[model samples]
Target: MLAAIAAVAALIVIGLIIGFVRGRKKQGLPQEPPPPPPEALREDRPKITVDAEPEPTQPLQLEDLVPRPPEAPAAEARVTPPPAPPADLGAFRSGLKSTRGNLISRLAGVFRPGRELDTSILDEVEEVLITADVGVHTAGRILEALRTQMNGGQLSSVDDAWGAIREEARNILASGGQGLAIDQTPTVILVVGVNGVGKTTTIGKLASRFDRQGKTLLLGAGDTFRAAAVTQLEVWGRRVGCEVVKGKDRADPGSVIFDAIEKAKDDGIDIVIADTAGRLHTKVPLMDELKKLGRTVEKALGRPADHVLLVLDATTGQNAIQQAQLFKDALPLSGIVLTKLDGTAKGGVILGIVDQHKVPIEFIGVGEKVEDLKPFSADAFLEALFESPDALDPSEEAATAS
Candidate 1:
């Protein structure tokens, strides 16, 4: 067994040596070459030199870094528009529509197309003027002027006759076309009228007119005989941004006016429009009261009332003239405020009142609007009354003709 073990061990050793030799031969046999170095492994490897320094970079500015949008153009200056002219004349013309038809149209008929100026035509003209509430004296004066023009060989054609009449009427109204002279500070205007003659409304409208003119105004509700008069004045005061100085029921009008003037003086008011009891012109007690009220206003201001505007109802015709005369006799009236002029065909009463009383017609209440109480202009009045279609501009004439 020992011998078999030795021989087996020898064979095992020879086999192990042979196996080792075979492994060695296999290892020694040529294999695939080892991979190249890491630098040489890349196909696009760059050649690098170690001597050169890198270039410096610049910092970016706000204007250069990103793309910018284009600039916008400068703005242009703005223009202002012009102011509008006053429309009082146009309003006056519109208000005189009735008068124009009643008086002007009748006069125009007398001087129809080619009618010659004759005494008969003059008589008819006098009748028309009188019928239109132009008082007998005023009509006669106008007729005398017309007859004088005729005697002087000036009134030949119907146009001449119309021109003469207009000239005479204009001359009569021109003197009384003066506006209320409100030159004083806190100008006092004591408005007096008969009952039912729109006395309060006239005061309201007048206040509105003065307010629109940028004048600081105060109203005096001196007509304490009527409670509505006080409230009405208050309403107007609010409407026109004026303060109203009122009295108790049936308070003395003069005392109310005195308080109003004192208040106006204190408040730096530009005007004080005082209302008075609307009394009958012929009523002695009431007229004396108005005279006392006027004196009170004078006493308060240390001067006569700047204006004693007699508010007359134009629709009353010649009765208006009579009323105005009575009021003139009672109070020192500066001017007249003709109300309801739009309601009357007897607007010719304006001519009569001015011609007879010699008192200026300061304002005419043409319509119910506040602005309708226009500052009286004789030229505007005459133009509105007598401006024929032939007086229109060519463009307007063409339009009319068409």
Candidate 2:
């Protein structure tokens, strides 16, 4: 009887627990919510493009966005500028030819770069330029510049030596070239050289250059003595689509210059390039004429020949040095334009002229075509001089038609 009573008590307790659980569920209490886990979120992002092709809109690719390289500076040298034909190969034409020939020969001979430019080689270079008629002070300056580099333990290989010399020469030449700037209104470029130096040809070519620049110009036949000078300038002017102003062959050069200026002003022309007669050796009368021309133009144009570019024939060798000195002394010569390089052998004389006068070679005439004028680049020139004729700057030919 006692055992049966204990069993009944256990059953009652189990029933009471079951009833409590059912009542909570019915009351709408969240059925024992599950325990939460880890969490995260999501969105969109962009990317950079580098190199993409021109396919309309392929959603610019990353590879298509590289920056473009900058253009090279005008005189930035890859090698050498080509040789120019000698313009005023007057007295030393044969000698100039010889120098140019030697350059060709040396260039053919494995490009010695001049015996490693040892003290001996440098001295030889100095002597070569001096012998070619470069002035003493100018030669000394070049030598000293080289000497300084050597003393400073800078020059070693032939390339380095040449580079050092070239750098110094270029710097000096650059200095002289920079000061004589061109003008905007009635820009005047006075070209003066002794007779038969291709002055007229240069003028024609120069006029053509301005024509391309959209510069309205008038060519003044200041060269009255040469029988064909005025006509030649006229031919070039016609070819280039410009105007020419002339007086009788014996007319005063100063008066001719003034008249040209007056006409240019009246017509609103942009430039007046005067082609002065090829004044020959110590012609005091002609020199006076040039001086008078300068003064008269200053009065009329408000600017004397802004640029007096001296024309030298490379074939003239040492005489080129003398001519440079004469012209430089006679007029405030602005720069030099060398011609006849394509036909002559005395190209080294160019360096001598630079060494002597500190004049930057502004242009070089390489051929007979009107386009054959090129700007000078020291590095390219040196390379050509040291390298083969094949190494000559292509622009030398390119300028032949410009």
Candidate 3:
């Protein structure tokens, strides 16, 4: 039994020793450490780093940005202006050339530079006045006034004599207002004249004047004796922008005037300028016809004509004064319109007409131009005649001092 037990102990000890060697071999061999947590493995991976300071960048050019639209071309710059006309006084001076040359120049000769104030000077002045168509009676009156001044010691020098004559002329020419008296509404102006005295032309000019004054005007072609008269008046009416009442050729002028008056009343016209047949003042039959026409006007309108304007040719000289007298007898003439004043040296006839007939001179035709028919002003007329230096010719200066 002892032997068997000892043998089992030896076997056990050998087994034990082998197991210890196997255990030592397993422990001593190189072994990996336990895998680290997932976080620790990620931390060990390679990482990228950035520099704190950066380099500067280049600036952008105009071509790099969006382009702008081109501008439109600029426009050029400029300025402009109107016209002018001749002055009234200049026209008047030109128009008076004929009369001033003929009459006033001759009158200037009467006042000789060294001549004494004597009756001889008065004689020369009287001749000058008479030669200018001033009429013998009017010339005599002027001479008488001048002689009285000379005798009163008022005249001493040539200038004094001229001044005396000027005063005398102004005194004779002093009158009521030369303007037409249109006190009543729809004032009727009966324009009467013999043939070829510019009645129609005067009417046209008067119409233009009234139009410029802002007056409503109506023209009546009462010159029924002439066929062309109606058409002529109509032309003027259209030119002046006024209405015209016309009759047939040789139609009753009174009838035409009656129609005009009625039309003026209806249309609220301010004036009615009636053209009449040109008649010889000496023709009794024509004069009677004029009277009948006046009666017709009064009968139709229930009032007499507002004004009777007798137109006369200044070139007719003394004949115009006779015509004025005859017309005054047949029809009451309120005023005279002296036509062709620029054409005639006998513009002095105005003084005779006013002196003999006591009719106021209303207007004077200085030229054929529309604006040449001027309202007669005694002062302006005398000033234009006497005050103009150019009125006296150089040759006449020697004659004046002779």
Query: Which one is best on lDDT?
Result: 1
Q: After superposition, how far is residue 45 of candidate 1 from its true place, in Å?
A: 82
Candidate 2 lDDT trough over 10 residues, lowest sum: 36-45
The CA root-mean-square deviation of candidate 2, after full C-alpha superposition on the true structure, stands at 21.8
The C-alpha TM-scores of every prediction are 0.74, 0.64, 0.74
Q: What is the C-alpha lDDT of each candidate?
A: 0.80, 0.66, 0.78
The C-alpha stretches of model 1 lying farther than 4 A from their native spots are 1-87, 389-402
Q: What would the per-residue lDDT of candidate 2 be over residues 269-369, giving only the tens digit for each residue?
A: 89888998876747777677777777888898786677888888766766777888878877888889888776555566676677667777887777666
- Ranking of all predicted structures according to lDDT, beginning with the best and ending with the worst: 1, 3, 2
What residue runs in model 3 are displaced by over 4 Å at the alpha carbon? 1-88, 388-402
Tens digit per residue, CA lDDT, model 1, 1-402? 999999999999999999987887788754343454566434345644435544333344343554545432221111111221343678667767677767777777788887766888888999889988888999999999988888898767888888889999888987864567678888998888999888888888877767666788999998888898899888777777678999889988888889999999988888999888876677789888987887888899999998888999888989999998888888888888888878567788889999999998888888776656777878878888787944434432222100
Question: What tens-digit string does per-residue lDDT give for candidate 3 at 82-161?
Answer: 11132345545555666676668877667756777678887788888888888998898888888888889888887788
Root-mean-square deviation of candidate 1: 26.4
Quote the lDDT for 366 in model 2.
74
lDDT of 1 at 381: 84
